[model samples]
Target: LPQTIVDTVVTTWRLEIRFLWIGSQCIIQDDNHDKVIEISCMPQIYGNACLTILASRSSSVTEGFLHERVISNDILCAKLAVKVFDQTAKIAHLIPQRKNVELEPLYRRAWALQERLLSSRKLSFGSLQTRWFCREMDDNTSLKDDSRDGWTFRERKGWEELERFELLGHWIKIDSQTADELSTQWYFLIDTYTSCEMTFEGDRLPAISAIAQRLAPRLGDYHAGLWGRNLLSQLMWTRVNKSKLAKDATPSWTWATAVGHCRYTDNDLTIPAATMLAMLAMTAATAFPTKISGAASAVTLGMSVTATAQAMETVTPCFILATLRCWFTLLKY
Candidate 1:
């Protein structure tokens, strides 16, 4: 085991936790079967844990996170004196910069993304200080000492709260309101997850399998990185930049096949409705040509069909039907 992991174990013991589930130690690395089972159970393990310790400061296992942090001396602090009715009080104000968790080495790892999201409470040992994050509150030890001069730290509470919402939203029961909401959030997650570095291209889907498993109950079916229910909307994902397809068994239709950052088409009217419809239609034709050519073509279009149905309120349904009939007739030939 690496020293960082040993330090983590020691930290867990200090917290009085009896058992610790170290991925390297608990899972049999040599056995593929064991890895698959363990990886699938990640959601349960991390979600149920009382506390998850993150070595955010360490890039690799060899560089232990327990080492001292080099505090910068460039911080500015001002002491002010205020006169009350009878007495004078002094206040020391320290300007602090918020730490960006995304910049952390551990945050870049593909596996760590799901691990962090799954854990209810995370105690991250960052380069700046030891931070505590949970659904209720997020704090850091650096802020406790008011007398300290250099570089006070402020935890990014907004980002932490957003993460908590993302975690909770997945487990919530699926309803009309939550279904679309959660599906949108899932796309946002994919945008972030795909940007992270992965050592093995094949592990892309497996790394996020726990998240998929957790969401499967609410989202219906799991089809690669895309969900089954709103597959047409999900297929609206587009690559951010030029990227190559993965040399894996994953189908080209899914985002998992591409080894690059991708984001969903923003429904904010920035993209023309016609263009969006065309993209959705093309995605359907490419991904499910058989289904698109069959009687269930409108059903397979998912949200695109709904949008067209709404538009039909202004236009004639017969005209639209005839147009689609001609289109499909040509598609068949």
Candidate 2:
């Protein structure tokens, strides 16, 4: 009945619908004594779109059966997927909502929602009303047609629409930028998902790759570069998944640490940002405590990394030039 459960289900259900639509085979494996569910098809699913569903389902369910499969691989995948899908769906559909929509109160509304979800406290009506309107505006600033001339009313409507568009645009920009920035990083994580190498002490590499890809496509360019790197860094120091790292030794954190060590900040110009990060990622795979030897597949793997880094470097100066032109255009606007 709770909003959290409802939201969880809606999100999870959508992913389930997507996976089912794609005919994905979900596999749940027990690694390091914990049950790890891996949902994949021939191409495999990437990003966090499926996570809310799986995590919510896993948290909310007791019984887990959907489509029955006689084949072992299909059976395992189906069972895991069904269990995860159902539980999360149940949780997502029970969230509550307010009757009135507040204009231009985005962050404040979000804060209130978070407080209500995390703590059992409801926001004060007076506070909500005050926050709903801008401080300079009055609560009685009737959205009604009688108060203003036709032109003024039309202008207000246009401004409101523009504000909403800008908000949505900003969100889209930040999200897409992040994914673009971290695309290669997620690719690295996906390729070396089972590795044990790491830089920080306690990090969750699986989640890093999983969510980073999903998040990147929706972020703005500048913010994406900032957060994608931070998210990679967080995965590097994760201690909870340490046991998994010990067994695999090709931990995702290795890249995190390596990238951190060889960072191409404004202060340091030994290597360009694109080149340094690319090299750090490739180098970390081999030099870490685990020594995973990702280079072993030089013809297949090493070549890709090498080519990608080279390509990014070759194209970067041009990218920067294009970006500056766009910045100037926006400033002129």
- TM-scores, all candidates, are 0.69, 0.24
Q: Which candidate leads the pack in lDDT? A: 1
Candidate 2 at residue 268, lDDT? Answer: 16
1-333 per-residue lDDT for model 2 (tens digits) = 444334444544754554321111133333422212331111123222222122111112232212131222221122222356457322111111121223212222211221111111111222112112221232234556632422255444444343331122322233344444443333332233323233332232332332333343353221111232333232222223333323333323333322221211112113333442322233333332211111112222231121123324342321212111110011110
How far residue 175's Cα lies from its native spot in candidate 1, in Å, is 9.0
Tens digits of lDDT, candidate 1, 298-321: 234332322221222232212122
Model 2, C-alpha of 86: deviation from truth (Å): 38
CA shift of 121, model 2, Å = 27
* Candidate 2 TM-score, true structure as reference: 0.24
Error of 1 at 161 (Å): 5.4
| lDDT of the candidates, in the order given | 0.63, 0.27
